[model samples]
Target: MSLSLNLPESLPVDVLAPDALEFDRGPTVSVPVRSLRLGRSPRTGGLNDEHCRMLAAAGEALPPVIVHSGTMQVIDGSHRVRAAVLQGRQEVAAVMFDGTADEAFVLAVRLNLVHGRGLLLSRADRTVAAARLVTSHPYWSNRMIASLTGLSAGTIGRVRGQLTAQTGPVGTRVGKDGRSRPVDGSSGRMKAYELLLGDPSASIREIAKRAGVSPSTAHDVRKRLQAGEEPVPRHRQVPPAQEPAAPERAVALPARSEPEREEPADPEAIIAALTKDPSIRYNNIGRRLIRWLDGCRRGVAECPGIVERVPSHNIDSVAALAREYAHAWGEFAAALEERNREAC
Candidate 1:
């Protein structure tokens, strides 16, 4: 049975509710342990023995597992399910929601990607899994899979090419960004051309909206018109007047120094510190490290900040720690290398 539910492309967050870890989650229910399924795919991963053991110890007190409302397929609890079965559990707690197989695949990939325990797969393996999703969810588009799976669109495209059925009916409007956009690029560009021709003196930005193109595109057309060329269709190919060919002079400007780039946080220090805590086990600490690192990695992905951005005063401590990251990172790496050699 196919279930229909709108799955958001971006990570959905509820502003009004404080405890919504994810959006569109359903109510919790008790499911038979034997009925529950594993949450990993070849693209994601299966349960770890250590993780299963930990969950088994948690018993009835373990956190609820997430399952698909349609198929009752587990989306994020392979370890927990395995543990319950091992512990002779009759039933396991689960949270169910409606979603497609494709959606489930992506959700599994994403959950594993950002989870505290993680998928435990190598980068290439993870990419291969995410890329395969392109074939399963064609409407999912290359970029959408890339974003959710944390793989590159280029990688996803390569995977999509390997599929037997690569083409399908394209109805849902997708942006170059791989997500839904305000307008389709083709129609928007055409509209921009129409609006540009309609009013030669109208505001470029305003015309861009009517034309369904970006303001920058409209501005480009304006500049072309100002340069004695037709903005839309080719009217006159030649310039009206040739300027007196003036000799160009080279001007030398003083070289400017730029501020040192902020260093990215090394997860090693955080990992080490968290691991050394007597209260937390190594496995639990590792999971927490993964969670924190995932957040930090995603935060730094948009680096080379947007131009004309306002300063963020609230995260001064975070900013300071980041600045000192590289220095401590070297020490952590060296120590890890030494420890590995000693073990070998």
Candidate 2:
């Protein structure tokens, strides 16, 4: 009778040429022998002495287990086989798996590469590798790499920036709004700096996003580093205080005493005299004079009633008088016109 079994193509049943040559029967044979080399190739080796010893002890207690020879490779498990030989066992039982030497070498290298032991991947190195994988692997995409690694696509690009990328300062000061200064040179500034330090190709936008600021702000920080200065955070400048406008009209003085001056011809002259002599009081004569000159430019009658009645009219009084002057000037001009008409 014939029997058929199905197995995966990748996992084949016969790398057992050496074992088939050594034993031609389907049943176990007791052959008195010394340690015999099973296969040629450095890759294949036997188990350590400890494992062999344990297996031997177990065999003594129970029936000797049959070793599968189908998967054994001359190049693979060679060390393990050698260790079994060193233990002086008549037969070292092993289950072997096989592949081409070049394939095995490549597989080893790739495994080590992923673990970052045989190869050290810097930020730049990782980005470059990821980029290469993105190009080569059908299953890998930029977004997949980014999502898996928690890096932005732009940052990944920066991590692999050109070797000729120049060193420079970032642009703009950061603002409270989390935006960099509105300057053209400031774009991607910070990203460049961080990339230079870690992965030079790191995306400025990503860094800015992480920093809770706009890309420009991050770039400004980069500029600071490029300028050979420590980067300090910036804020808006406070505005200066404003000054008030000067008064338009001049202050009018109190009337002068008759002792030093003649009866003033005009109300202005009287006011000037009174104001110049600070000691002069607003007495009955002074009040009457003030009233008679009420039609004049310097008259206090047109002022707030309280200002006119207040006797202690001082500098403020003079200013009030000036205000009054301005207020009465038109009335005084009309009165002068009427008088002139009467005379005509």
Per-candidate RMSD vs. true structure?
10.9, 45.1
Give the Å error, residue 66, model 2: 18
The C-alpha local distance difference test score for the whole of candidate 1 amounts to: 0.54
TM-score of each: 0.54, 0.19
Q: Per-residue lDDT of 1-344 in model 2, one digit per residue for the tens?
A: 11112211232223223232122123432221232234322112223344344433332322211222232233222333343445565554322223554333322222212221111112333444444433333233334344323346545334334321332223333332333443232223333444545754667687676655557666765655555543332222112232122123322233333332211233453354343221223246655555555454533445565465656637586777677876787688678657644533
Q: What stretches of model 1 exceed 4 Å from their correct place?
A: 1-26, 39-45, 57-60, 116-125, 140-143, 161-165, 168-199, 220-344
Model 2 residue 108 CA deviation (Å) reads 5.3
Give Cα-based local distance difference scores for all models: 0.54, 0.37
Q: So what's the TM-score on candidate 1?
A: 0.54
TM-score of 2: 0.19
List candidate 2 segments past 4 Å from native. Answer: 1-76, 83-100, 106-203, 206-344
Q: lDDT: which candidate is best?
A: 1
